[model samples]
Target: MKDVLPYFLFFIFVENVLDLFFEEDLSWNDSFTSVATGIVSKTWDLLLAGSFIAAFEYAGTCYMWNNYRLLDYATDNKLASFLCFLMVDIAFYIDHRLTHEVSILWLGHVQHHSAEKFNLIGNLRLSFLKIYRTWTYLIPMGLVFPPQMLFFHLQANNIYQFFLHCKYVPKLGPIEWIFNTPSHHRVHHARNPKYIDMNYGGVLIIWDRILGTFVEEDEECFYGLVHPVNSNDPTWIQLHYIYDMYLKWKQQTTWSHKFQSLLKGPGWRPGSPRLGFIAEIPEPVKGDSKTRIDPPVASSLNLYVVVHCVMVIGSVFVFMTKYEKDNTNKVLALYLLLCYLSITILGRIYDRKKYAYGVELFRLLFLVAFTWTNEGSMVQFLRSICVASSGFMITKIMEPPESILVRA
Candidate 1:
């Protein structure tokens, strides 16, 4: 995890560009309030789906952990289980493909791809527009692999992909083949004609090759969905596509046009001005400039998350020393005692250009062993991450309320 710290910094840098463009002081308190506003403003989807997914992921994690030993053994020798993982990942790839092709599945996936920018937050983005969307692959995985192996495989795949989101590295020559590379993912995000709807593989690029949907990254890759829309506000991101479709319908001269517009495929171009097209392919200009989103986090938040995690590292140690004891110290270290207070407080405060250097006085004690790193103090480190994660959840909860966000 420490090795992947640079990628987090890279994410911040990208986000900073957007923060400045929008002149987003985007305070923590405002974010929290905005999230609440979004939740209250939601339409078209109830909280039930979100509730179910939350419970599903939590329950799945618990069940998987109980069988960790077998899972670990399978992973201990990569070559031994490579064939097995490949078979299972095939199911994973198929599941991912369906998310784009199926209308109902796209509803859930739209919440994730809805983000305008490509950054660290984008990597973690998932939605509960419908229950089971987040863990949809588990159903496919269950058909073959045990629950424990499925969980570990899923975790490993995500951990690797998190690093792949970085803009820092250009390409890793040989490694690019066996595993999904930045180049491959760049193609995945492309909105161009030949590039669109291609490269759906996660761990292996061969899946795309085998499926005949593979498109190599040759021209410069432009990352984002078609019909340029920009906003770091998670609420806006969630509702953007859905609301855009409604606006497209409202703009249409006839109900037939409106009905056809919504029913069209991913790359469809509509007659309405609001959403000229639900999707598009690049026509190719003589010279179309590329766009970059944010500046590298003048400070990286990765170290901040790591420090917060370390606080809880000694939890087992403390537990053994004081069995059946309630200790605030370890709780302070993990920083997860009260999930609501921790999340809410962080949501209410934020500084876009923040590096968190002076936040932790306690870190000074271990200057020789630990640098101040990215965050201010240890406590501030926890605050920063909690703010980000909670802020996003709040935004998601607020967007597309159960009633209706916008009319079709």
Candidate 2:
């Protein structure tokens, strides 16, 4: 099926809500569902809708491109316009293939294939990584096709691609030889040796056949990378590979390796690390889950938690010692500091999964030790001892049971 169905329904949902208000029916049940959660969700639903809308624009631009056919032949030169399309499209074909070969491009392109399911929502996945950061190959397009013609064609090509990212469609019959289809695309998304670098197409699949890069999809196909990125956390999934690349690049010994890592093959890693190919595919777990972790019982100090604790202690000191004077000012400053600390700790816990309640407790106290703020400038020097005590207490509480870090 076309990837637009769900998006269309969502768009309709918005319209349907408008109808209830406009039709003189002030009843709450006039629409199928309420507007607050109907039209969109804060997370994945919105991203999918955005991707769908983006793809829809591709359709509009393609319509314009097709209507403005033989775009290069302003002088009624049919042969020249066709030639321009051919030359420009060939370059696009090559660029698409290079995306897999280039680490930078893979980061973005992986987003397209990262979804385990082949539904319309899966097609909407996007990573901040550049699909093809540099379009150096397009400089020659200026020789014949005007930038406007070429630009619209590129958009049209992308719009045409949204349809191929589905599961309902079969091979394009004999036209499969010339056009891209869902089956061919399945091969492109697979990490199997036969499917690794094949089926590089935009709107047409003949490019693969012509370039000798074609590989047909068989009945058995495994999608995603060899080591599948199976997280439902969109933020984690999108940025995982990028962070891995960054850490690898940082630990790299030399500039050449660092530079080469950027252009490594589809499976390349820092040292050509083993576990290089096959993956032990796991059974899919249905539904989303929010991770809950235990707070550390002991730690010298956790950074965010420590900062959080200091504020709590500062608030206490504001009340305990009146020597600093400015009583109302001290209370206000203390209250603001403690509130800011708690909010920050909660945000940090949400983002960093391993944060257990133990960690929070330590953070709570680290916060309690920073009361010197109300002590004014005179006793600010006492902050170091307070900080150390907080750190030690956190460390004592968080010291592991020994087996935690040392994997058996």
Using lDDT as the measure, which candidate wins? 2
The per-residue C-alpha lDDT of model 1 at residue 117 equals: 40
The reply for model 1, stretches above 4 Å from the true place, is 1-51, 57-84, 114-117, 134-137, 247-264, 269-280, 284-408
Stretches of model 2 off by over 4 angstroms after superposition? 1-81, 129-135, 250-255, 269-408
Report the lDDT tens digits of candidate 1 across residue range 77-137. 5563565578656766786776666433555566545433444445534543634565555
Best candidate (score: TM-score) = 1
Q: What C-alpha lDDT values do all the predictions have?
A: 0.48, 0.51
- Model 1's alpha-carbon lDDT is 0.48
| Candidate 2 local lDDT, residue 97 | 80
